[model samples]
Target: MENSKSWVIDPLHSEVLFKIKHLAISTVTGSFRKFDGTIITEKSDFNNAKVSFSIDVKSIDTNQSQRDEHLQNDDFFSSDLYPKINFESTSFTNVSGKNYKMSGNLTMKGVTKNVELDVEYGGSEYSAQGQLKHGFEITGIIDRKQFGVAWNIPIRSGILGLGEDIKLIANIQVSELA
Candidate 1:
C-alpha cells in the first residue's frame, strides 16, 4: 500500500552539503552540485514512509579546483572507482514533534553502513507554477573511516589533515508527479 503521492526530486532546488574539521582549527565545507533521487511515500503510516537518495561522488566542490581534483583521486573519495554514494531506508520512527528518526543503509566506497537521519517535514503546498511541492530537511553524520576513507596526514601540533567525522546536510524539494 503506497501513499499514492509520487514525488520527483528537483535537483535545481536541492542541495547536498557536508562539513568537516580541517586540522582541528578550521572547518571545511563543500557540496555536490549534481545529484538526484526520488521519494516514494507509503501511507500505511506516516512513520512507515520510505526514503532513499544518491549522490555523485565526482561532483564534489569545495570551491577549490585543486582540492576537488585531489578528492577525486585515490587519496580521498576515489571517484573513479566508486562513482556514487547511496542510501536506502529500512525503517522509520517518530521521535517527537515534527521530528522523525530514519534508519537506512549508506553505501560509499563500496562499504555499506547503517546510518540514521533526523528528518523534519516542512509541509507541502502548490507552487506558483501550479505544481505541488514537498519540502524536507535532513541532517546526519558519518564517520569517514567507516567507509574506508582513512587517508590523512598527522601534524606535529596533534591535528590531523582530515577529520574523521563528516557532517551531512540536505535540503530537498520534491514536485508531485501527476
Candidate 2:
C-alpha cells in the first residue's frame, strides 16, 4: 500500500452526532462519546480515499440516564451483545465542487446494510506541530429498524414516539500517520 497514505482520526477534533424526530413535534439530538476512524488515500485530493469508522454503542448518550440505558438495551443498540457499529467504504463518487457521495456498508446490532454518506471536503492544512491535517464533513440517514433496533411506541396522537429515520453527521479531522 505504498501508494496510499493512511491518516489517523483525531477523535478530539472530531464529532459524531445523530438526530431524530421525537413525538413528531420536537427533535432529539445526541452524540456518541467514543469513536475512531481512519482514511487512506493515494491522491492528494482524496478522490478515492478508503474510509473506515467505528462507534461504540455503549457510549451513546442522550442526556437522560434512563434514556441512555434504554438505548443500550435490546430495544435499541443492545450494546451488551454488539458494542460497536462499523462502516466500511465501498465506493466514492465525486460530484460538483467539494461534494461527494460515499457508498458503504454499515453494521449495527449484528446487522449490516448498505448506506450512502454525503461527504464534503474541507480542504487540508498543516498543523502547528508540522503535521498534515485533513478535514471532512459527512452525513447520512438510516432506518433504525433496518439494524434490528426496531423499538417504537404508538401514541394516542397517531404518532410514533420516535422517528424511524436517524440522521447521522460527522465532522472528521485526520493527521497523516507517520
Candidate 3:
C-alpha cells in the first residue's frame, strides 16, 4: 500500500441508484443515502486500481416510507442482520478509451458473489477547491436472488411483485488524498 495514490469517494458529488421492475410493468427506483468507497492506484489512468465500497443497507430510500421499511425487513435487505453491502475489486482493467471492466466480489445479506461491471472513466481534473478528482460511471445488472434477496410474491403466471434482475448505476466522484 506504500507509494500508491489514494482516493476517497466524495459523497456530496456521488450517487448510487438502483432500478427494478415492479409488477412486471413498471420500474421502481431506489437509492442508498450512505456509502463510502476508496480507490488506490499508482497510475493516473487507474488501470489495476484497488477498489473497495460499502453501503449502509438501512439507508435504502424508495421515495416511500412504507416501501423503504419493507425493504429493510427480512423479505428484502434484512438490514437488521446484514447492515452493510460491500464490494472489493479483484481487477480493474481498461477495455477501450475511457471504458473499463471492473470485477469484484459483492457481499450482500451475507452472500458473496463475483460480479463484473462496466466502468466509464469520465477523466480526472482539478476541482474548484484545487483537489484532484476522478469521475466514473459504473453500471451493472445483478440477480437479487444471488445475494439472498429472493423474496417475491407472485401476482399471476408470468408476473411477479418484483423483478429478479436489479440494475445498478453509480455516479462516483473520488478525490485524491494529499
Candidate 4:
C-alpha cells in the first residue's frame, strides 16, 4: 500500500438517507445520523479506490420516535443484535466521465450481500481551512429481505405494510489525511 493516499469521511459534511414505500402507497424517508468510512487510493482520479464504511444502527431516525424505536427492534434492524451496517468495496470502476460503479459487500443484521451502487464524483476542493476534500453522491437499491429485514404485514388488496426494496442515497465528503 505504498504511495497510497488515505481519506476519512467528514461526518459534519456527509449524510446517509434511505427511502421506502409504506403501505404500498406513501414513501417513508429516514437517515443514519452516525456513520464513518475511509477511502484509500493511489491516484487522485480515485479509480480502484478501496472503501470501507459503517453505519450505527442505533442512530436510525425516521423523525417519529415510536416508529424509530420499532425499527430498532426485531421487526427491522434488530439493532441490539446487529449494531452496525458495514460495507467494503470490491471494485470502484469509472463508468463514464464522472460516473462510476461501486460494487461492494453490504452486511446488516447478520446477513451479507453483494451490492452495486452508482456514484457521481463531484471532484475535489480545498476548504477555507485548507483541508483537501472530495465529494461524491452515491445511490443504490437493496431488498430489505436480503439483509434479514423481512418484517411486513398485509394491508388488504395485496398491499404490504412496507416495501421490500429500499433506496439508499448518500452525499459524502471525505478529507485527505496527511
RMSD of each: 1.7, 1.4, 1.5, 1.2
Superposing every Cα of model 3 onto the true structure, what RMSD results?
A: 1.5
- The segments of candidate 3 whose C-alpha lies over 4 angstroms from its true place after superposition are none
Q: Rank the candidates by lDDT, best first.
A: 4, 3, 2, 1
* Residue lDDT tens for model 1, 1-178: 4545667789988899999999888899999998878767666334766777889999999999999999888878889999999988898777886788889999999999999889887777888899988787889999999999889999867778789999999998998667
Tens-digit per-residue lDDT, 88-174, candidate 4: 999999989999999999999999999999999999999999999999999999999988899999988788899999999999999
Q: List the residue pairs that clash in candidate 3.
A: none
Q: What are the per-residue Cα lDDT tens digits for candidate 2 across 66-147?
A: 9999999988888999999999999877887899999999999999999999999898999999998988899999998998
> TM-score of the candidate numbered 1?
0.93
Candidate 2's TM-score: 0.96
| TM-score for all models, in order of appearance | 0.93, 0.96, 0.97, 0.97
**Which residue pairs does candidate 2 place in steric collision?**
none
In candidate 3, position 101 carries an lDDT of: 99
The per-residue C-alpha lDDT of model 4 at residue 98 equals: 96
lDDT of 3 at 23: 93
